[model samples]
Target: MFIRLPRKLFLFYVSVFYLIGIPVHAENNTAPTGSFKSKACMECHKKNNPLLIKDWRSSAHANTQPITDCVACHGKLHQAAASSSRRDSTCIRCHGGKKDPVVHSYTTSKHGVLMQLEKRSYDWNQPLADANYRAPGCSYCHMHKAGHNVSAGIRDDLMDKAAEKKVREQTRIACLDCHAPRYITRLFENGERMLEIGRKKVREARSLIEQSSVTFSDDELAPARAQLVKMQQHLTNVYLGVAHQSPDYQWWHGHPALDGDLLRIKGFIGELYRIKK
Candidate 1:
């Protein structure tokens, strides 16, 4: 009787071979070759751990990609794999880098901060799409019925009025999963007000830059221009802080920082005026 090595185990050996400079000629140049059977995975896991199988069945992953499987995200060779497979990093297998803009913005938020602090105590076996975690992580909020659509409730470019409305509606629905309707509404209203204030600050800075630009050469106005760029970035941080419910980011890193940038630009413009006179 012959025993077949699991697909993940076989791939592990293949990698070792490559490291040792040994040649390999895989028939399909793929990990899931002819001998690998996803059914084999189900048969054993169903008997051993039916709850995990059930979670997978209910997930968008079940009906969708072939990549969303046992060995695909979780790999082989483990002490039953268990909750270890259900990490945020596992989502990154397909979702990509920690530095990804959406990922970065969220990580800097209160939700992400809480998740980072309390993740060790979380029930990793809980269904992420169902919002079963204590604090919402990437999968908890974004994993809709359609699968990992990270941009579902996100309004990165608020200038797109149509998109803003759509994303606002979606964001409301997502927030309602954990918060009161009144609270969500109030937060949205406050965020809009804050964003408007930030925008006004930016406009004031732009007018100053424009006034200086009219009299001075581009080279002369370069310092003010650079400060304007920094102010814009700080304005964006304010937007992120509002959206992400990060108070520290909203005040200290955002509005206050923007104010300082504006002051520097204003001082530069004043000096330019003195030089002109």
Candidate 2:
């Protein structure tokens, strides 16, 4: 006769088998992505350095992008030797690049130059409150309230109606503290108009480039490609320069260069098409 196992024992064994199998499936499914450990940093800082934590919590860095943790700016070894002298470099890591027009514009702006000059004489360890800083840095305009939201007034979302309204409102509030309401409004309007013009020019240049690709040979396309790239760079520079409060860059380095590149591209397209005909 076959011995009957108790129902409880049978169910217990089945449950253990399923439990063991589930983890193998789950491990494959739940592999880690590169997510920041911001909560861990916050938890530790909140207890050990309450004031610093408070400032960071209220700033745009903590509020906006979750990935932008203490390690993002301060680095992994910040606890041992955190210094404000490295702030510009740390910020530039993300902001000041060839592709990043906004922060890159700041490096060529008057404020950026002044900040660089002041840093030569200023002490990194000195408290910001006590330090006689000459010009505004990235933190001065964007992080006025020790805010972490760098995108508060300087977002490139003016094309969207809802985003435009929100950005304009935020920009107004931010500008009013340092500038008159009329001046701020005028400046924003002018910048917006210039950006629209720049966009049209870039689109025209790109269209010409596309046309050239079909009409011209690989060797002939090199110059067109170079001009197109230069035009795009200038367009981006001008758009960001206006927002960053650098009229000289907007006019001299940005719009003028863009216009020249656009003209060159147009000439190239015309010559290529004429030769094809």
**Candidate 1: which stretches are off by over 4 Å?**
1-86, 90-110, 158-162
Clashes (backbone N, CA, C under 3 Å), per candidate, total 0, 6
Can you give the TM-score per candidate against the true fold?
0.62, 0.61
Q: Write the per-residue lDDT of candidate 2 for residues 113-179, one digit (tens) a residue.
A: 7887776775544333312345656665555444445656655533333455566775565456556
Candidate 2 wrong stretches, greater than 4 Å: 1-39, 44-67, 75-89, 97-104, 117-134, 154-163, 209-226
CA shift of 39, model 1, Å: 20
Cα lDDT for residue 203, model 2? Answer: 82
Candidate whose lDDT is highest: 1
Taking all chains together, the TM-score of candidate 2 against the true structure is 0.61
